[model samples]
Target: MEPLARRTLLRSGLLVAATAVAGPALLTGCGSGEESPARSDGKPRRGGTLRAAFTGAGAGETLNHFVGGTALDMVRARALHATLGDLDPSAPDGVRYGVLETIEVNGELSAYTLRLRRGLTFSDGSALTARDVLWSLRSPAEDPASLPVYKNPAATFDFAGARVENDHTLVLPTLAPVADGRLLLCQGNYLVVKENSDFSPEVATSGPFRLEEFVPGEGCALVRNEEFTHPELSDAPYLDGLELRSLPDSEARAAALTGGQVDFAHDLSPVTARTLGEDERFTLTSTSPPYVSGLFFRMNLAHEPFRDNRVRTAFKLAADREAMVESVFFGDATVGNDLLSPGFPDYADEIEQRPFDPDRARRLLREAGAEGMRVTLTTGPETPGMVEVATLYVENLVAVGVDATLEELPAGQLFADYPAYTRLPLAASFSVPTPALPLYQMSYGGQNPAALGWDRPDVDELVATARGTSGEESARAGLAAQRALWEEGNTIAPVFKPFTTAHVPGISGVAEDLFEQFPGFSRATLS
Candidate 1:
């Protein structure tokens, strides 16, 4: 398995662009009477404090985004640091520029040259330079050797050959040719921090805002970074400041927005989002397929039953995906076909969608000599509909003659011990739809200590070949790798949930990013 060091980049701007073109028609079925902020005739009125809420926060939150895991951590990280680029959801292939003025990839795709925009500076009055960028890129992989306290996963880039061409330009060499080098660098966690600086809030940041205060498990406050500049977005830091609060419960998050306690809220339940969408006071936004939310069942390949591919196939065949969507998700999601969701680049749609065949599952179980296999499926309220999805899965398993029991962990307790979560014989988890290559690398490729054991040298070679090639050849190789996962992967993704967010009528630019799980408030303005 190849090491996947890619970051999760949210192409929030894609939603904004869609709303701009579709106008009120986008919200026609959901509701009417309220004009979209993105479509409003009046120019954006800046200079106000925007408060937002997200689901789930813990004391473990840290300024070091490389190690941060929660939605709040990502929100704060985006406020404090900027990445090399961001995905453009509006584009057919989802491509966009972020901090980098230009990224030039060689014909073979093994080498990349990043040219930073002129006059870039951090919040602490430090000039942004190639060394800071280099440190940010290399430290995640090299820091464990230099500092034992650092344990975050390193990216798979070949940093040994990195070169600083000038104060504002740097060259990055990949171990193999990479067709999506720009996409890899723009991951949500790949923000740039000052070189040799301790990982603290006081450290200079290159994002649109600087951290003012952060109380783990609670929330944080941010102030505009006066010195920040980017080549893509003309208006930087529209809000005077931002106040982010963590409201883990879906109902609570929706209430916060409705009661005027917060200007924006994320991760609302489908029922709540529908209610809000019908009201004229708020605007609702959603993205599907490649960018949708997903519920997955990970079977530890090291455990009994799962170690047998027949048993795994049995479980996959038995999944009632459409039933789960209608019951658990309230008809707010699309059915997944075991690989990456549709509508994304390089998704393997040709792979046949496994049917909900209980008889076939039973036969497979019998063939594997696992009749009456009683296994415990652990799950938690990690996301909005996770617990419901887990319960539904247990029912499906039992229907196929498997005595599946449910062990529901507390809201955030499932991930308290990272190793424990991965070692569970069977568990329910959730993820947002990300790019195929990065998602495969992060969750399945290499010796991902936290991933369900499903690895093969041939698959790794396929991925490497896919990353090294360009054009149709690249797409063909990538699709082949994904097809392999669909057939033999250890995880079963049955549904792609919508990424739902709600904001007040006056707010614009909140849909500019997917990372924060809300709007990019830096570009947002209150009318």
Candidate 2:
């Protein structure tokens, strides 16, 4: 009963969008007086270099996609290697296919067949095959340097039992029935490279851009692959070449864009965005609904003060969400409920917005014998809004009669070590828009450090029920899981905002970029 009905019950990004916060200042990726790529006049001038900047980890950055230390490292890897598939809201199947043309899943949800589009080739003109996909998928499990999340998922995929049916098709038997298997593998991170490809500049990659030069901790020089073609895009990679610059500081990134050193800046701070957004030289942009990031503050249950559920609830109730959104984002973002993945179908957004009530917070604190607890919120501007949100939350805590202070980590060190991050008493984290069930499975499934000590077997069972069912029944199970988590979850997610970036007016055709911040130059043009 293998069927191609994988996208029947759920759509990943194109699911219903959360209602936007009402204000003229709220900017959609293409809306709010900004010129969308589709509305631009004249043809895209196709032969100029597009230069962009993103934060980089000095000396620790690696081209190995399996262990990319910073956003810059991942961005460079995306430029140099082609994707297996990417989550695209506009795609019919919710995934923009790359080398792989189709994913066929069995009725039992126990197996999958990945068929590569025939005629796909690397820069060296070697035929790209199913074995290449197999290698790229298996490397994460075997590579010594791979991150735990990549390495840990190996248990779910029966790579050793997988078989290539042909040069272009591979059949895989799953270790467990994961209904969202396609999303698990095709979520824009599992790129397809030639087997044993060392990822050096000389290695033949299948992406739209070929690496011309690379310097560790710096960035890469890339040229368009004339032979490269996407299954879904027409004459992509409109630029002749691209230059990626590493600017770890958000202000420095914004400065590079304003000073004409680069054409685009990745993830500018809200303060910088407000300064440059109205300027004639730069155009500020954020992605459309459902592409936003969930800005969060988690109370580590492993630590003191936050160990009590009442105290955690008090922390959540004390947040001034409206102030956080208005002050940090300047009204460009949506206020978050206490839960994550609001736009997703099964997120239980019907659970109602968590209100800002320092009175309730104080009452809870009093009842819990913690009316004057001391806690420090460790945060940084990993993205634009984090630190500002932390500042406001700390202020709210002080108002609620708690001793809350802020600790700002350096730009690159906030998440440098996962275990250390989990051990912190109070912290900030963010989540990109993704399906609700899988979103939980990522962190809350087991002892994943990202979960921050949230381990609930009952909730896990509800998620299992959700995944193993379909339609309304699946939604009910998911909602039940979310209901339990929302009422008791340790994280205080305050706002949801798009991945905002500022670019010169001359840059266009990037609204469909894989990363909203670092425009994937695949379809972008520079005039």
Candidate 3:
């Protein structure tokens, strides 16, 4: 099958400005403080250091993002490496190109042609080429030591058929027809690195900022990448530099933001978000639904009690989602059905919402011949409010004749080892707003190595068909696949917590990226 012409694809201008699209709900203030000046004039004021705080800092941090899983690692990687594309908050299913000028897939959707923008160069003056793109997409999946989170997606591509047609054009053939091939290339860990180069802070980077210094588990400083070619991001170095710090504690992050220690803070507790929302000096932004950032748990089907569908359904019904939201989230989130949040492109909203019925939960357990089931709910302080949510969930489970106890691990321990979280019978987790297909592909897809025992070949086929087609056909197939998940998936998401971040009024142009743990600081500036 012939790929679409480059001219036709470029004419579509799929590579629109990240901020031009619909973004998270921004809560701006009308105040007259030096820190919160009126921005009636919509112009970027370039030149100042932007300090940001995020959770997850550890000795495990590395320049090799394929091996790094922390939020701090992602933020640092964003400043150092560039991906072929990224997810736009406004267009949940859309792909925004980065280094690539255009990507056109063959009619069958089995092959994709990627064209690099002209004259692209890395921070160290190395030319960015199609070979780099091929390597970035292939290495992670093929390397046995790469992080499983990234390895899973890379394993789906047919790298053996990849061909570099020219210095700027690369053909990426998939193992099978895929509808979201472009999005797969844009996964955060798939960032392009120079071909054949060792992973190091000194390696040439093609992103908006170059790594200046990195101290694992501490923080790093970044300087603007003078070679950055993205017009919207490189018109000028918005901030002269960026200083990212690791603040895992919610109270500490809030204090850092309010104490003027940092200009931006991410993953604050709902109570802190509400308090800061009232302060005219800070701007609070949040994303809900299809972009859910909330408490959830994945049940391992390999376990005896969870092996039965009835038992899994019982756990879902046992969760008091509304109570968890009101008590743990301080009424800052929406209740989630068993499926993905509503408004996401593939979300099956018509699916009936599972009510919090403890009696029904007990009946289901009894019918499954598993009455008085005892299980340990493993969780951690990985995100703010997770422990509290887990505790509440345990109480709910216990109320329904299930002997559920809580085992809280240290921060970052849950995901420290790949598939470690999945090994547990039941574990608490959280997810940021991501498109339904990609989320399912990474977590529940048949090929996923870390799948929590929820494997359905029919649902897999539906997802494949959805990705291979476009427009109405694509939406219909995608929805059908999501419907299957809603009916039988093991993950129990009761609330869609907002992805909250607080920034000083002086900061602007922080793009709401659904893929990244933190907002894109590439285009951020300070007045």
Per-prediction tally of clashes: 5, 2, 3
Worst window of 10 by summed lDDT in candidate 3? 11-20
lDDT tens readout by residue for model 2, 1-527: 01122122111111111111122222223311233343246665667777777877656666776766466766777777788877765677677777888999899988889998989888888888999999988888787556555654465579999999999999988876767777767767677888998866688988889877665555567888866877776678778878777667777676556545567778877777787777766788777557788889988878777778889889989999999888888888999887887776667877878899999999999999998888899997677777888898899999999998999987666777666787888889777667788777776776556777887888887887787678887889899998887789998988888787888776777767665544566888765
When 2 and 3 are scored with TM-score, the better candidate is 3
Each candidate structure's TM-score, on Cα atoms with residue i matched to residue i, is 0.86, 0.86, 0.88
Q: Return the candidate ranking by lDDT, descending.
A: 2, 3, 1
CA-lDDT, candidates in order: 0.71, 0.75, 0.73
Best by lDDT: 2
Q: Which is superior by lDDT, 1 or 2?
A: 2
Q: CA shift at 249, candidate 1, in angstroms?
A: 1.0
| Candidate 2: Cα lDDT at 216 | 53
User: Distance from true position, residue 447, model 1, in Å?
Assistant: 2.1
Residue 292 of model 3, lDDT score: 56
Q: Over all chains combined, what TM-score does candidate 3 have? A: 0.88
Error of 2 at 519 (Å): 2.8
